[model samples]
Target: MTKSRIRAAKPDTQPHFDYFYDKPGSLPGTLNIGVDAQPPVIVLIDYNEADATRQTLATPEECLPYLDTESVSWVDVQGLGSEDILQRLGQVFNLHPLVLEDIVNVPQRPKVEDDYEDHLVMIARMVIPKESGGFHSEQVSFILGKHYLLTVQEEPEHDCFEQVRQRIRYNKGSVRKLGADYLAYTLIDSIIDGFFPVLEAYGEQMEDLEDEVITKPTRQTLNKIYRVRRELLNLRRAIWPQRDAIAMLIRDDNDSLISDRVQVYLRDCYDHAVQILDMVETYRELTSGLMDVYLSAVSNKMNEIMKLLTVVSSIFIPLTFIAGVYGMNFNTEKSPWNMPELNWYWGYPLCLAAMAATAAGLIYFFWRRGWFENFSDVQDRTSRKRG
Candidate 1:
């Protein structure tokens, strides 16, 4: 099946949770889909030890024949755009009204539900790395039954399950021989593993941001830092509950839907969830540190500029005083004390020499105090500004 059946989310890496809120007084089990949503694509894969088959079905009713079979059946629905199609799938799977509501709802948080006797439902957030420096995320709902697993996704594109699909098609592992519980575990593990590559990209972006925060922080740098923090918060919100959901799966051994063997595998999947949460937390802290560093850098740069300007102003103070005293216009003819040097031919030259000497002395004093050396940052900024 082509992975391009779903549309790409917006190019930005923002929270991908599809929030579903009904009218305040709306009845329960109401299905609300985005008007722009595309009709869902249904694909069925039925397999036993000896045979395996894969086909795209036109409608959800076509999945009924395989759902009751002894062999493992995987019904994959790729979109939640069509309310009629979703309602049909719910009926075909004998889904509870609330379960149908949760499934159709874009995002109902990351949790695992086993209230229904026939199936175990797992709601998770899956992320796909985008080529343009961010990630695309969506909701993946898993309904695992005795002999079949029904998987529904928010969108059909940017799929992270191609490897699992390949493994199932080629029988690379025991996924074919195992029950739907194992298939659920495999796909769950794949979904959790999908977070690693996305986290790696975040790690790289944060490293670049660390340098940018210190070297030369700009408004754009601040914006990027804010985005990284917001996105990481979204990631934390996603993976935090997911860890509890996975834990619930492992702890709820009474639910006969999931085999003990698969639960063991789920333990490892839970570990991955915990690991992803740690990464999100670590990145969040790093982004916060980047903000602090940006502020300090800007403040420090401003201080350097103020220091340079102070030194320049200090050097001119004495020269201004000398000129001010000479311009007082005292009449030398009235008294000797008025201005003894005013009639001298060398007075103008002496005054100019005095001003030049005063400036040089102030400059030397500031340089001796190491104030001039501190202006290196200011000098660099000035040079760049000129350039």
Candidate 2:
């Protein structure tokens, strides 16, 4: 499979569903195709209760024969880089202009729409956990009709639908026996379940962060927390609206495209969406708390350092005073009262002994008060933890 490094078409990002960048007062249904998009790869899977068939189609028109047949047709289009193929595919499927625009604009919010009367249009985000770390996310657009389900994705590389494909190919279950709506639910359920591994990765990272933040937090630790928080926010943004969309799919009685049986399956999908949202929110809160803990740990470290410096300074105060008094020039031979000990043979040794004794006493006093114990305890605890 070929991969494309798709670039952002607009410098500013679209923050939500209601806000987007486009020419002011321009046509509503205009497509914003990315220049670096890959050419589309279309796959068709047509199945009935007896058997199923899967093939790659060279053109959008090639699947026209199966669209109106008794078998359920699933046309999977991966990549939106080629404008001609996308436009032609829209034409072949009888897609509305706005629906086509939503499919191609890349990064529309997850939503469900049945306004077109013949198609149930849904937009969803799929995330795949990277092997190194973090995740990759993309937009998946679905157009469900009477006898067919058409899916358009942003790229070919970041898909998690191989399991669903395998199930249909091997006749492992009832997918071959179901209609297009059930097929749509299977794919949607796959998308919902995909978030778990990504969340699991984040959960493991959060556990590691908890240890690092408490024991050995540096500026780098803070940066990691912020990064995790930002990504979790992305997960939240991608997932929270999905719960709403799935709920709409389950409760949307007016959309005749979704069967009653499919809605029952969709209820389970909705619960998974809620569970994923809860996990995202929980991770976000943990990351935030980690930030606060980091600040407190750093501050406490600083206080310990300041206290050590204070104890050292206190010990030196008296020694400095003793040195200062003897260093003052005194005419010992001219006056009897001017430090007579300067004439003694042991005066030098005596002065040194007094300075050492003073420092020792002060240190002993501080140690007895437990000021020095925490430093040693901290070192011991750190060493033990590291070991």
Q: Please list all clashing residue pairs in model 1, or write none if there are none.
A: none
Per-residue lDDT of model 2, residues 99-149, tens digit only:
898898877789998778778899999999889787888899999988899
Off by over 4 Å in 1: 1-18, 330-387
RMSD of each: 7.7, 6.9
lDDT of candidate 2?
0.86
> What would the per-residue lDDT of candidate 1 be over residues 180-223, giving only the tens digit for each residue?
99999898898889889889999999989988887778999999
Q: Which ten residues in a row have the lowest lDDT in candidate 2?
A: 11-20
Scored against the true structure, residue 201 in model 1 reaches a CA lDDT of: 93
| Model 2: lDDT of residue 51 | 83
Clashing pairs in 2: none
Q: Where in model 2 is the C-alpha error above 4 Å?
A: 1-20, 325-387
Best by TM-score: 1
Once model 2 is optimally superposed onto the true structure by TM-score, how far is the C-alpha of residue 225 displaced, in angstroms? Answer: 0.9
Residue-level lDDT for 161 in candidate 2 = 97
Residue 299, candidate 2: C-alpha displacement in angstroms: 1.5
| Global lDDT of each candidate | 0.84, 0.86
